[model samples]
Target: MGYSRLNVVIRADASVHIGMGHRVRSEVLAEAFSEQGAEVCFVVHASCADFSKEGDFVFGSESEWHELAHQADILVLDHYGYDAAAINALFQLNPNLLVLDDNNNRGDFNCRWLLNPLSLRYSETVQFPLTGGQCAQLRPQFSKYRAVNPIGQQKLLLTFGGTDPLELTLPFIKSLFVKGFPTEFLLIMVGSGVQNAKEIQDYCRQHHMECQIGVNQVSELMAQSRFAISAAGGTLFELACMGVPTHFIQVADNQKDALAEHSALGWCSATDFTGCLPKQRVSLIDKVVESVLKTWQTDLTQRSQLARECVDGLGAWRVVETVLASRLVK
Candidate 1:
């Protein structure tokens, strides 16, 4: 059967602590589901910003999900806070469940499908049947772009995802300036919900750098940049898509494993910001600056090729097809 008014409820959350990757990815899924004639709604926390126009957002307690669970033809989860028990409850309410996870750090989850591109074949290592059975590898939608030619681009982009809760922007700029990070290449910093925006803007102005707040055309920016210093989160996929060689720094726990794997695979260079308090990051500026300059000097031909090859923009379509096929099977 076709997706005629099929109800898809996406459960996720966004905040300074949780960051925005989950919500952003969920919005992408919502778009794909909506195109297939599904009614998509978001069940998020009250603190979450209203970022998507494609769906309605609802706020309530965990018990409230039962109501949504009852109405949903399928429930998609992206939030890390949801445990197995909670997911099991939702699964009992509605058997059609799909989980989008990165680390697989959580315990057992009784869901019909689990989408994790990183560990698709490493399911045995993570103790989950995430490879051969009901699991599907879902990459970001940016993998569809052609390799970016870096000849004319004279900018170094900096993005730390949505919140930058660790406040790495200003320190990174100062480190670059201290290391004299090529004044010929302009610096372009972008972010949202940044508490230190004024300080960052002032620093950029004083240093002749360009700062863009709340930018919507991030893909365009990434494609145009010659280099980037970014967080090792979902944005890494976008950077990889454009073949923009990046130096990644982790600001969340979920990103640690992926950072290690990606860096080991030569996709990007990484640094961990976990455990180290925000105040202590200032001392690590030299290390960050050294890594960025080193990576910039190295030839990126092979690294760019590997990065672009990892993701294809067709993941959303794949997910939609798989979900629909599973429904038909039922």
Candidate 2:
């Protein structure tokens, strides 16, 4: 059952437009595959090349994908840009194709296995298993940090993915200030993709607040925060693993359903800002501030407990096992 001979190639991309959630989660799964003795490589777009490791391939053409598909024993794809045609082309090269999906809105996939951590619906076309937050691929630091009590200072950790494509960081902070929220209670973590990092840093400095850009030790920051306001993406699962009561904002169309599901489960508070104008967003911020305060006052402890119970921080291993099991059966 050793995976030493297996060659797993993960294909994903990150940029200011799409954010880095895809690449981040793919790395978590890649780490699990590597730990199981499998050789792993990432094939990413050029825009994301700067964030990739030394041996990672920066793909530019279809021929490059064909070459990777031919070489890979199992091709793990976690990109949203690829349609069915692109996937089918890869499946033709290697039958052992595993796709990491969130919304399952790509019509149909030609892969051997399809995994959606947000849902557990049966699929007739491909094998779908371990479909829940229990399969969320978070880094090892989250689980290690989870062992520590997360009820630290009353500070709020704020992040909006790697890009914050919507530019929610400064606006959110300004709204908090406008609402008379304690300036000392904010710990802003700006993403590398954010174009206004300099401005955010300056604003935080002027207000005597803390701000960090492109931090690798996010778990440490989460451990220091009793609550959080984050975008509804992979970070939600990570915060859940850390047991930080969070209020998540929907910044994308695909996040709508997941937000509703998590909210219904009492894991976190949810808000939708997908199509709001600048003025409307400012108004919505008032509602978000109210919700954050209400949740902090009413059910912070319960939400934290529910979130921790939802994701145990071992999902990457479970996914690796599933892939290994498939190889064994084959």
Alpha-carbon TM-score of each model against the true structure:
0.88, 0.94
Residues 56-152 of candidate 1 have per-residue lDDT tens digits of 5656567756788677888888877788787777777777887888877777767777777564343322222332211222234244334445564
The backbone clash count of each candidate, in order, is 0, 0
What is the C-alpha local distance difference test score of candidate 2?
0.83
List candidate 1 stretches off by more than 4 Å.
Answer: 47-55, 120-150, 328-330
lDDT per residue as tens, model 2, 52-170:
77898887776866788788888888988888888887777888888888887777667787767787574566754568988888999998988886557467888988888888899
Q: Which ten residues in a row have the lowest lDDT in candidate 1?
A: 127-136
Model 2 residue 303 CA deviation in Å: 1.0
Instruction: State how far residue 179 of model 1 sits from its true place (Å).
Output: 1.8
Q: What TM-score would candidate 2 get against the native?
A: 0.94
Identify the candidate with maximal lDDT.
2
